[model samples]
Target: MHNWNDPGGKGSACQADKDRKDATRIAGQLNIPIHIRDFSQNYWDDVFRHFLDEYAAGRTPNPDVLCNREIKFKTFLQAAIDLGAGCIATGHYARIRKHQGHYQLLRGCDPDKDQSYFLHTLGQQQLAQACFPIGDLRKPQVRELARQAGFATYDKKDSTGVCFIGERDFRKFLAHYLPAQPGFILDTQGHPLGEHPGALYFTLGQRQGLGLGGVQGAHQAPWYVVGKNVTHNTLTVAQGDAGHWLDALRLLTSQPSWVAEKPPGKSFLCTAKTRYRQPDQSCQVQVLDDHCEVIFEQAQRAPTPGQAVVFYAEELCLGGATIEATDAAFGGLEAST
Candidate 1:
């Protein structure tokens, strides 16, 4: 077995150390030879390129998704094949199965822990050479098995930190990498409400860390980021229980990467998740020349651009794409196409 320690440390040295120790322990227990392939420099550069590019494009990027596709399944997978391994397996909460000679990506049995959202970028070839041994078991069942085997991580808390920055102050960490262009925080009416560090630091529906409260005319309540006007360097926010600014019924996605190497059909009905662990919502899709437009049965809240929209039919994953834009409902009509 090998641990592909690709060179990259956005700022998580401790996490890397912990991961190494865990890898070592697992290798020793399984009596397998462990190899550490260092490619750290390349790893960080690749992910940073994706992160910065997306944020600069006025979109919220999921670095974990890029890391999985570029590093785990691409760089590391290739490294393993070069070392004469026929297949590679990960602890990700996802499953793979073959039906009628075509491999399909499935959600792990544990709905709460399924990671198929972040893995939708994986293609058919990658799925064919990959395995997920724990996908069939629930989190508790896996924990019980680990406890029986006396694994130190039998009850280890799942890492909820960002992939690159861990749990550090996101704005502070990002400032070191990207210049913060201070901008105006405006309401939907284009009235300036406040000032922000930068639009790149915020995402759609982000409520916390906004540092907004009781305004002169606004209500005494929390505010949410509803939009980022990249051209004008403005951040749009809205207040109230129903953040109407954050609601959307239609979204266009960048060219999707399907698990079957092609879409099922030009248009079809399926359940989709706009974010991880989000309950599936029914949607109708229409394929575009360069992207696909999805119309949710009910208006969705905060369909952030640059985040993934994973499609699923029950448990089978149909793959996903980066959200390009969303159509907000305003005055009972489309706000943005």
Candidate 2:
């Protein structure tokens, strides 16, 4: 199984050493030799660079999705093939099946830990070459099995946010790659309430780390980030539920890809999620050659651009696309005073 050593953005330089120790210990127990591969260069080119570009564009991106498609499936898969391997496997909580001469990507039986959303970019080629040994098992079941088998990573805490950030302040880590652009924090009426280190550092519906306490004309209610303008270098905040202002009913995405290479039909209805762990939302889809448009039955909050929208039908993963634009009003996000 492949475990990425470098995840991106300020990942510890000694990450490889840590991985090697665990991998060596486990391989020794299993009486198998482990070959450690360094794909950090490939990771930077295919995953980290794209992540930085998306953030620079003032849009949040999911690096795990990029890493799965680029590093795990593309680069690592090729390396395994070169080493005379028939197929490669990972510990991802996803499943693959062969039916009617086509590989089907399915969600893991462990619903709470399902990772199909991150694997949506994978196509038939990757699916055919990929394996998920624990997809049919729940988290606890897998952990118990690993305990019985004496595996070191069985109890490893799941990484959150960006893997490379690794408990480090996200703002501080990102500030290193993208030079800080200090700007004013304003309200809906263009009133400057406070100052922000950078407009690109925040996301819609975010409340913490804003440092907006005791601003003039601000209400006693807690403030939330409602909008941002990267070009103009400003952030917009609103008290109370700023989330409603960021709700999006429809979104447009770039370069859609399907597991079967073509969608069920040119237009179809299916379930989708704007982010992981979000309940599957019923939506209507319209696929174009260049992009696809999805209209949700209910408004979704903060469907950030540069993140992916993954499609599903029952347990089968159809595919996904990169969110590009949303229909949210967002307090007239780019409006300048």
Candidate 3:
């Protein structure tokens, strides 16, 4: 496996010191010669710069997804093939199956920990050569398997934050490069109700940290972030009322992928999840040449623009795409065509 050391080979200087140490320990235990490349400063700096550039362009790019598709699968796969590796695998929670001479993507059995959404950006070729050892098992089962196998990370707390940057508060990490700018907090009706520290700090459906108070005042009933206008520096919010939060939406997806032999045509029924943590909701899917749209049966809240919307038909993962737009007006509709 190929891994890059974060800046200065500073296994000692960076927050990822523990990871480096763990990697070393694992390699020693497995008797594997781990080759470490020192891209260090240039690699990390370039990634962060690209992230800021995308965000500034009003596009919510999932950096992890990009890294996996572009670097890990594409670049690393080629390198591994050159070195005569038979196959590659990762800790991803996605399953691959062969159907009609094509590779299909499926959700891991662990409902709560499925990560097929992150792997949605991968194409057909990558899916063919990838393996997921823990795909069929739940988190607890994986831990038990690890314990039985005598692996040290059997009980290691799940790693949080970005792939190699280690766990840091997202706002704090971004603030280091992108300073927060104060913005206006508005109600759904475009009424100014409060002030936000920065538009970049908040996301759709976020409830905490708005600093709004009172029993019956603006944001008094535990407001949820509804929308954001980055250009105007305004964040729209709503109370946690069923009527205010959305139940359904018209999700415009760009650059869709299919793991099946045939693409589901326009207006087909399926289940989908807007966020990784959310349960798959019953919905109808429509496939276009370049995009697919989903309309959930029940209203879902905070379908953020930059996040993935993964679709499923029972156990199989059809595909997913980044949420491009949402319509509050279409929330109560039976279907969104």
Candidate 4:
């Protein structure tokens, strides 16, 4: 479903009009019937609202994951079924296959464009009723096919990041909804280096938009966000791009949605990605009563809480969980023995 976040399209230069026009032309070309459904309220309530709440609570959340689970699959999929459609197809670059009376989600053939990372939350029912027509095709092949079809959108630039936040200053956008609570930016030694607009506005390991380039008495080394204290309204930073405090070798997650109706086992070895486009990292997972623990084979950098961590076995996407906390070991850990 297309986003209805922009009303009248004034703020974004009439992008809504252009999208509608392109969709209408394409539908006409294929002789397929199209319906215009307003899902503005749904998006605001289910996706964007939660995005704001997560940020307010001192976490960075990925809206696309929630949108795929709540709006795209749940709301839009149900709507399509009501229209007498047997199954709905979309442009998502992921594949679904049935094995032993169950459906399995797989990565797209185009590794660079694989979107199963965001689709890991989907369960058996959603996978059964969903179709990804381009899952087996590479991106260039799809683009060439579209070019052969005389479609105007064949060469459209791919959109990245959060679509609603498009090209606008993200910090400024947050300021519009969350009032700035200016606080001191302190160094690792508890020395105040400068001031920041808000601790909630930044995330761990972030080095940009900190506005600390001109601080005196600070070394020439760059600063990285290592800690955020909302209670004291303080932001603690550390110098050096390879700061030891941001290393996260283990993390905890909320309950996960598994593709096989349960985790592969009580504990299993799998490759996982903590963020989109991140290369798979070797990790060992242990399932618990209320949460799951992941121990990385190698120390991970900045596995931020509130982001989704997806598990993979070869090309199969097993499932995913929302990161709850990480052992961001400060000053490095000593040997236990």
Best by lDDT: 4
Give model 1's TM-score versus the native structure: 0.93
Kindly report which residue stretches of model 3 are placed more than 4 angstroms away from their true locations once superposed: 1-15, 38-50, 57-60, 214-219, 242-247, 260-262, 329-337
Best by TM-score: 4
- What tens digits encode model 3's per-residue C-alpha lDDT throughout 270-333? 8888876677799888887778777777767757676778788888888777777776542222
Steric clash pairs (candidate 3)? 7-40, 205-225, 246-299, 247-298, 247-299, 247-300, 248-299
**lDDT (10s digit) by residue, model 1, range 1-87:** 222232344456667778889879988998998988876656667876778888877788888888889888988899999999998
Return the candidate ranking by TM-score, descending. Answer: 4, 2, 1, 3
Weakest 10 consecutive residues of candidate 1 by summed lDDT: 1-10
Whole-model Cα lDDT of every candidate shown, in order: 0.82, 0.85, 0.70, 0.86
Model 4, C-alpha of 115: deviation from truth (Å): 0.6
Q: Would you list the clashing residue pairs of candidate 1? A: 6-40, 7-39, 7-40, 7-41, 8-40
Candidate 2 lDDT over 34-135, as tens digits, reads 877878778778888888888888899999998988888988899899999998989999999999999999999999999999998899899888899999
Winner on TM-score between 2 and 4 is: 4
After superposition, the stretches of candidate 2 with alpha carbons farther than 4 Å from their true spots are 1-11, 14-16, 331-337
Clashes in each model (backbone N, CA, C under 3 Å)? 5, 0, 7, 0
